[model samples]
Target: MSKDDLKEAEALGRDLMWILGLIMHSGPEDRQRIALAYNQAQELVASIPKDNGDARPRIVACFERSDTYKAADDVACAGWLLTGMQERVNERDLPDWRKLRKIINNTVKMLTPPKPTIH
Candidate 1:
């Protein structure tokens, strides 16, 4: 990949991290944004050139969403690491930054589910 491609990938990584941040947040707005970012990140991850090893399967396994405790742990750990790295990339304001940020912010807002109000 050229320097530009590498930079683009890093920017995507940052957006992915922000999405993770949205996922963990209980806020309504951020929740939607997170969901959008999460989907986008998944798509981006899918697009990366496939290399040797079982990393792809393993990453997909994390998203499998099974009832098993081990499965949950795998997903959590892998997702956390990827998301964290993505955030670092996002901080740099690399290419494709605007669209990435906008989508993540919007998705986080959309992801919020209804909650009971305190009387």
Candidate 2:
């Protein structure tokens, strides 16, 4: 979203403002999280669990050749990569970056509906 480092940082701030707003207003039933799925992909790079060898299958399982989500393969990895990156960056003593990640996770949580209470 940026033409250069400075522009990228500014653009990221602007984008974060909008994202934060959406998260606050979006109820769990909303599909708004899908819009930011690509950005969320950064999580995966750090999320390759030591026991989960060959993660491709897990990634591939989410993609489907369908009319509604033809681009799922590309966007589905956002959350995974974002989470992975967050872990790695935090390990490097970056508290501020971790704050941004908390916001992202909150957004995801907001997009998820509360489990039904068995009546």
Candidate 3:
């Protein structure tokens, strides 16, 4: 990858981190904006070249894992799980990171409000 590619990836990483922070904190009323940001981050990751290296894939996986947990009904538990996963990543424990990602992703399913039907 060229210098520009690396730079773009770094920027995307920052944006994704910020979006994740927002999503974890935002209320249900703010779902639309959070979802939009989430989609944009996914697009950014998708636009990066796959052959660049494993970095892109790893980063994408992190986001994908977090996404899986976004559906979790227990907000507190999901928040704690996310925090622990973040810590594992910070410690560079690849094995734990991978495992936590799967656990978090598989555990949560966002609770969506019901839509109104015509009478």
Task: Quote the lDDT for 17 in model 2.
Answer: 58
Clash pairs, candidate 3, are: 71-109, 71-110, 72-108, 72-109
lDDT by residue (21-69, candidate 3, tens digit) is 6555668855554344435444555565555444445354545655565
TM value for model 1: 0.32
The C-alpha lDDT values of all candidates are 0.47, 0.43, 0.45
Output the lDDT of residue 66, model 2. 17
Candidate 3 shows a clash count of 4
- Counting clashing residue pairs in each candidate, in order, gives 16, 17, 4
Per-candidate TM-scores read: 0.32, 0.38, 0.37
**The 10-residue segment with the lowest total lDDT in model 3:** 74-83
Badly placed stretches (over 4 Å) of model 3 are: 1-25, 56-93, 103-108, 111-119
Using lDDT, give the best candidate's number.
Answer: 1
By lDDT, the candidates rank as 1, 3, 2
- What range of 10 consecutive residues in model 1 has the weakest lDDT sum? 61-70
Return the number of clashes found in candidate 2. Answer: 17
Question: Could you tell me the lDDT of residue 50 within candidate 2?
Answer: 35
Question: For residues 8-97, could you state the per-residue lDDT of candidate 2 as single tens digits?
Answer: 334434545554564466554334444345334434333445334544433332222111243554322333333433333334233354
Residue ranges of candidate 2 with Cα displaced over 4 Å: 1-13, 26-95
